[model samples]
Target: MSQVRTKVILYNPKAVFYTMPLALIALASYLDKGIYDVKIIDGRLEKDPLMKILDSCEGAVCFAVSVLTGAPIKDALEMTIEVKKRFPELNIVWGGWHPSLFPLETLKETPVDVVVRGQGEIAFEQILTAIINGQSFQGIAGVSYKDKVTGEIVQNAERNMVDINSFPAFNYDFVPVNSYEKLSGRNQIDYIASQGCRFRCNFCADPFMYKRGWYGYAPTRIADELETLWDKYHFEHVHFQDETFFTIGARVEAIAEEFIKRKFRFSWFGTMRADQGSRLPDEVFAKCKASGLERVMIGLESGSQRMIDWMKKDIKIPQVYESAQKCLKHGIAINFSVIIGFPGETEADMDETIRVVTDLRKMSPEFRVSIFYFKPYPGNEIADALIADGYKMPQGIKEWSDFDYVVKGSPWIPEKKFREIENFKFFQRLAWSKPSLLKTPIQTLAKWRIKNKSYHLPIERKLIELIFDRQKLS
Candidate 1:
């Protein structure tokens, strides 16, 4: 007779993007299938996600949720609260960036019984084993939990990052690939070929989270998994969500060769640093483009060399131009993201950034420029400095929910500067956008306005806003 297997429910909270919850899938795929029955319910995909979650909680060993740092926290909190109310004995676990950053704070304030800090596959498996044996979670590395008897949160020693190749590839069977395809309106698969970033950009949290370490699956392994997944899903594109896809030029070349040799019929997108792109050989770029490389995102944070150094971006201004030329030559679409409004940044600094953005925009119609205001996120050198100087972070989850990257306005930016940036962002979009039959005249006017630095008496902006508002109402 077979023994009864324990049930585990993994949930993904609602968020702005429709990307697949690979973190939950990774954990689910790593668990022992013989002793556990796992159920994954994504809030974004469900109409009655709360009902589904509560239903799945019954007879489950634990209900786990993967969380991010911003708006998703609000929904995750609401769902977890209801689960805790109905099934008080069920272990509610939280993992992902937010919990990994503030494990003790999460355990103390929220209903989460355990917080899995970093590199959760091995640690999470150990956690489940402890739960099944009714044993203490005293020695589970990378875990923080409240002692059931003592009622004190016990923080475990940090877990060493393990080689991802040691684990099984993600099982896309955990979620409906078609649903994501429909949601994103693209025949694309979101994949992560690596974990952690080796960069130490002061404004980025990656360095703290990954400790300036990086690891990737073997090229053969990545190609093998992608081919298998393609055979199953038939996706036309693979969006590699790696932080730095071209970190190792040799590995990138090998991966491209593998894809070419396998005759994979899918285009791919990934990210690169300006320095990395500038250093890549023309032959490697040719190999990648031949392997269906459609686009690459390069983070050109600032045009001002002084500001770039201050941010520790480590890429010179000339490197940005070189990277752009290389991508343009390869006929690859490039999205260059720029950030303004850093603390202590002057008007001159902002002007320099705009200058670079404008120059890059002129490089090619295939090149795209995205402008954003800097938001201070914790666990980064900049945020730590601000905190050290008495810049209070959000007190709880409610405050943190407001920390969104896409939102306009930053505390450091004055109202006048903020409005100017907002106006420039709008006009910049119109100035460089592909000319539509109906909007060519407006695009021409936008280009003239940008060239002349004439934003005052912005009738076009007013009219556009009115039309948008009317459309929303209609």
Candidate 2:
């Protein structure tokens, strides 16, 4: 009898932005040199992803789709349903943040045949082996799949975190060479130097996804990868896509030293917690900038200490200011991820946040602020509290897909308050673009005024918005 080869199709559903699908690329690279045949389809760039997937599914053993909790889930589910109709014999799998959090629920709610819970590379490879050998899917770690005969959902043991250097470098052949960039005219590529985070912020899903285990590649390994990309592909910027790039200060210093030794010139940016930056010395920031660290994003969730405590952020408000100042002094651009409309936040709390951000802008003209309305996602401490307080949760994959961090927020926030937040975001952008000596004084004075409990007065609020709003510059 002739031998039949094993084939699997991986799908990257549409996202809010078009970045490299590192997860799919990593999986493809893992399976590429093995017995299994792998193909990747990015829904964001495809003219017709469903048709492309259908065409690719010919003689394929399984179709796997990875997703987040938001709109991407809808995209993945839609693709899975249509693929199932056309090829019912094919195995359908779901992985990534959403499925890893709710494996059984995902298998019960969707048409997916299997759910690969955590660290999918090893589990997925094992799945291919089992299918090829005509063995049972039972005893596979980090997976949930329905039984063929009884059709009962079988949840397997959770998988441990994988070593950082276990996988090979990403195979860029599956994706377009020109498709990835951090910004227009910036030939940048995003790279994940590490996996997992150790923090347990009440509102974050990192704890659930990684189970508080942080792991990263060696400094030399990361630098080697970056230099190879820069030398070979002409990429000038490296966006470190770690959840918190500055988790280990010594490791980062080592990375900077490696880059310095190599004499590589590449501007880079990464996200970090405010406390992490505060713990680092001024020399570290200078060293990083000297080695091409252009920007660092800090999650300054709130300016109010009370709100910070409520969020269980552990970091104090003073630490945030100190970190911002250090970054500004070192000529490193700061991107602040601020959140408004927390469950119990008062108008006074909101005023404090605005005042603090205004001061941050004064410190650095290169400040980039991203303000988001707080949305309660599943499997988070804050989301559970919100649900307990009568907030409605999304029921199915379709409903979950509608949840977006940028455009949508908690329903408990009043329409008036919501409009103010919208207006604040509009003004914050303006203030950053047109910073001057005159505006700094006015902003400081306004901060003092708002701090004194005059925030609720209509005239006072409108005056604050007018002075800071970006539209005024136009």
Candidate that scores best on lDDT: 1
Candidate 2 residue pairs that clash: 427-469, 430-470
Alpha carbon lDDT at 393, candidate 2: 86
Candidate number achieving the greatest TM-score relative to the actual structure: 1
For each candidate in turn, give its C-alpha RMSD to the true structure in angstroms.
2.3, 3.8
- Model 2 off-target regions past 4 Å? 1-5, 32-34, 182-185, 435-474
Whole-model Cα lDDT of every candidate shown, in order: 0.89, 0.81
Once fitted onto the true fold, the runs of candidate 1 whose alpha carbons sit more than 4 angstroms away are 436-438, 465-474
**Per-residue lDDT of 1-474 in model 1, one digit per residue for the tens?**
997888999999999979999999999999888898998999999999999999989999899999899888889999999999999989989999998888888888888999998788998888899999999899899899999899899999888888788999998898998999999999999999999998889998788777888899999999999999998989999999999999999999999999999999999999999999999999999999999999999999988999999999899999999988999899999989988888888888888988888888878767888888888877789988988889888877778867787768777778987777777778777667666688778878877887888889999988987676522211
